[model samples]
Target chain A: MRIAAQAVLYAAFVAVIGYFSTSPAYVHLAPGEAVVKLSLSHAGERKEPCRTRSEAELAKLAPNMRSPTVCTRERVPVRIVVAIDGTTIFDVVAQPTGLAKDGASTVYRRLTVAAGRHRIRAELADAPGGRMTYSATTEVDLAPGRLLVIDFAPEAGGFVFRS
Target chain B: MRAALAASLDACEAAFDRAFGQAGNPWRHLGSLAFLLVVVTTATGIVVYAVYDTSVGGAYRSVRAMSAGPPAGLALARSVHRYASDALVLTMIAHLAREWLRGHAAGFRWFSWLSGVPLVALVYASGIGGYWLPFDRLAQLSLTATTEWLDALPLFGEPLARNFVSPASVPDRLLSLLVFLHIGIPLALLAFIGVHLLRLTRPRSFPPATIAAATCAALVVLALMHPARALAEADFGSEPMTVAFDWPYLFIHALQYRTSPQLLWAAAGAAGLVLAVLPWIERTPHAPAACVDLANCNGCGRCFADCPYAAITLVARSDGRHLPRQAEVDPRRCASCGICAGACPSSTPFRSGSDLATGIDLPQAPIRALRASLDRALETLAPRPAIVVFGCASGVEVASVREPGTAPIELVCIAMLPPSFVEYALRAGADGVMVSGCREGDCAYRLGHEILRARLEGSREPRLRARVSRARVRTFWGARADARSLSAAVAAFRRDLAASPRAAGPSMPPKRREALDA
Candidate 1:
């Protein structure tokens, strides 16, 4: 009888394992991307394009952040606002805006995507030469799409884009 | 010194049996199962760590590499870790529930209640730490969420997460410390498990092989389907992460992220703590046998001997009256198994107040109820020769003795059977309904079977030249190993069922399963 009871328990253990293995596990990333909007209302005409920000960028954008990283391009101070599509993905270091040409001090962040072509864009939140916004958008092929975004400008104050 | 030590050891071993040999000691078995899982987790954790890297960038990639690397021990190790954890949880819940159900948690056993809370906490902490090692996007996110949550507590001034999130700000040493804590906590759990079993007299180690096999198989399936991977290499400042459920631990994260964090934590924590203390808090009014009057106490240590828990102590008193020894009941260990009442002498004025036999009596109403219950259960059995065997819950395995062709029935308690029901079965031409019970004083349900047996035995009355009885119910006590006893009782009942004149009286309707399944 004892042996039989042991056998029954052993069978139950096996069945339990079989049950769990077949069940799917739910997975999610923290500080994941969420679409947001930045309204640029000139003369009460609002052109608010949706932008996305990584959590770190949001923190720097936060009112209380101290000593946020700054990105410099061609010896010019540039603070760029990163946006996926039209949404601001991140606000550059210490409220940095625009792009930089110098690769050093470029702000890069990682994002995960499903396998497919994804549009990644970096636009100038605030730039020199009359609020110039040097913007770039491109479709990159990704398998379980993952990429690092690096936005640049010639200097901290200047940019190439006219719009 | 050696001789004295051996003598003490021998004496302790003897006392161990005396203390824990009774029923409801399965907690000892639960402790053993917990120990095995701890061992598996430690052994597997070491192997994963040897090839593991703590470098901020390398941590995630290293885990992925290990998962994809030599499939040798990795699969087995992962399965063992996963399933053993599941098994650990299952055993803990079962052990905890059983204690509550048996009312062992009430009274002085509250220490087991308090210590159990920490064990549960440790399970969650260590389980979360395991997911962090995977270093996938999900792992990264989990770390962020957990650390951020931890930082919410006043324990840490600044966000504790800041130490691990940024590239330069976060150090490998801090990451290593997290890893150390992760590995160390299970060891702490092991220590707690030791303390958990210390009070238990007999510790049963190793779960039955089937349970282990089921646990292993389920884990293997999980590992295969998900194939533990790093969703993406760990990069500081990366907000987008892929997260997967750890099932046990992830549910908390899921609840927090999807709903309100404070609410989830508060509700879950409170509910879990309450459940942990429930066994201790619940007080069921057992039959009158539980109450003992000191004045009615007899010198005979019958109650002391009958108690499954060593709750009763026979104290020698110098009172000059009728009794020399009085049975003192301890609120601490007394499970209230009232065998002492039956053993008390009838002539003594202070016989045991508990009448286990009275509770066992099958009055007419309960007998009809038992009949209805049997009718309901038999609806699933084939319309062939079926013997309904109603054994005490603890003696359920006795149903295995039913002849290959016979079907068995289950009941909550054997005392629910009335004498008329057995006569009704005989009148219906059905086979006997045998009520198998646990050994005399070992009933987990406290004298349930003893009462029923006494009622049946007491019904025996003599007639002219022969003894005639209305109900031909056969009652037997089943010892744990007495397969022979089980067989003899069933065999006798089977012969009686076959030989009875009512064998072909009425045919039972076809059971419902065939039509339902079809």
Candidate 2:
């Protein structure tokens, strides 16, 4: 009886290995990127954050960057904002970095940048380092921006980053 | 019909115990502690390789870093991985050979033989996967050889090696599949281990001090030496570098490179089948049933429960306590786990006695306790010419621990004292600890001295200088009653300590080296 059981187990083991050996799917992600989408509903029923694609709306950044201005990991928080000039050349979604903090760090619009001064202000994600803000202006020249809000959060989050 | 069924069942029960008698053997289990470490290795490897990226150059460094990294778990995990692999293969081989020698693996058990072949294959598959992860020169060559061999099979369409040219030429997805196999194979190996333990009561675990110290020391040394650096990332097209083989399993791979892969597989499979069916093929003669030491019996019911056959039953004794009652071991119904013997507090106080038991006698539990006491004493003692003294159970007990004196502390069986406690004593400010057990075979427990001797020799740890050198904590085995032997052992150890220069007394926080050593 033990021998029979051993045989059955061995066969099952082989079958599992043979099947999965061909290929297996896995999760992939880069460091420091947090992906989030908001769910808001004006009517009675609940709904997902499914704002549809309209050329005009996709082209513009959210004007109220200060309202939802905090992003955190653990207790640390990073406050930042996304701003763009009238010229549109880069898609916010394509940009892996730079997003706004409304207690969150996610981009919502496609903004273009060229070789000139542009300011993206950010603060430490949490306390002890609160009230600290850093701003830098850099040049960017690339394809004309499309509708993408490259969402980002500050390093202040308690999220322990694995290097 | 009922009578015939009963007779057949009896026969089966007897046969069962006849097969697994060694499961009760402490030496066998002591040896198998290696299995515990190996299991740890496979588990850690599965986790590390799971997250590994399989691209060319990246795969090697990533695996190297993961295996040798400073991460809290990575280095320890890799050590466990290697040790476990070595231990599993060693024990499996030992288990097979012991079965063959005992004539328990033959005849009607052919199915076990055949099934075991796949398990052996899976072990090799996991081993190869480990080799591949390093992506070192040898790793690339090994993979190339493997792929080339696969291509030789009529079923394969193309030579996969053609893709090794440029980074873009090789498909990352396909490489990912190989990495997946590397991860998946070990997880699959775990299933085999589960099956292996199904029929047994408890799978063996590593002996804490010996196994832990040996495994850690081995890893530290290996890390200091080879450091497990990766060879160049595997290129599908490049010719592999020539290298030595890992004798454990890859010997066959090297042979395959010389001969035909098909022939190698056929030979391996055939050999494995023979081994698996060995228990049934070889027949062990039935011996008389084991006698019970009822006086020592605590009525633990271990023997009663351990018996695979219904030969032993628990019945009310004169004092109204339940004890195992003997009945005929209807020869047809037994599989000798002697778990009864191992579990039997009566028949086996510490040692096992089977219908056909191994001649090794283990010291009783009291002796083991005495040894542990000696260990505890050294651990609690303060610095002196800090020295640990061990004396056998039958040896003279000193009136009291003479502070800074040259007398041995008595113990029943030194095997019960672990090496770590000695090291711990040194860290706590003891100069050294010493142990004395009975002379070789003369020990009342036949193998007590031998077992203690093996452990003492194996107890060496570099970081704990006080633990390793004879001047520090050391061990000697002689008749417990032999004052001359005890005095000489103590004198020698004391002389060594006194001759050596003493360091300043213990300071705050101790030294950095001792803290980081483990």
Best model number under lDDT: 1
lDDT, candidate 2, B100-150, per-residue tens: 433334432233333455666787787776766666655655665576556
lDDT (tens digit, per residue) of candidate 1 on B1-518: 64554445334323332443323223334555566676666777787788788766677767777767544457556655666676667767766654554455655555566667778888878877877776666666677667656644445323455544344546666557768888789889878876765543333445545434444455555555545444565554445434445555556766766765567767777977786766556755433224445544545665454344445677776455566777666555543333333333321211122221221112222222444555454545433344666665455465677555344544444443443344434334454556677654445544456556654565311001112133345666654444576777777766665576342454322332222223
Candidate 1 regions exceeding 4 Å error are A1-163, B1-36, B46-65, B90-115, B194-200, B203-205, B209-231, B276-282, B286-328, B339-435, B438-518
DockQ by candidate, in order: 0.10, 0.01
What's the C-alpha lDDT at position A156 in model 2?
38
Off by over 4 Å in 2: A1-163, B1-27, B64-84, B102-118, B151-169, B286-302, B308-333, B336-518
* True lDDT of residue A124, candidate 2: 23
Model 1, docking class:
incorrect
* Interface alpha-carbon RMSD, every candidate: 10.5, 19.8
Once model 2 is optimally superposed onto the true structure by TM-score, how far is the C-alpha of residue B384 displaced, in angstroms?
48
TM-score of 2: 0.40
Q: Which ten-residue region of model 1 chain A has the weakest summed lDDT?
A: A37-46
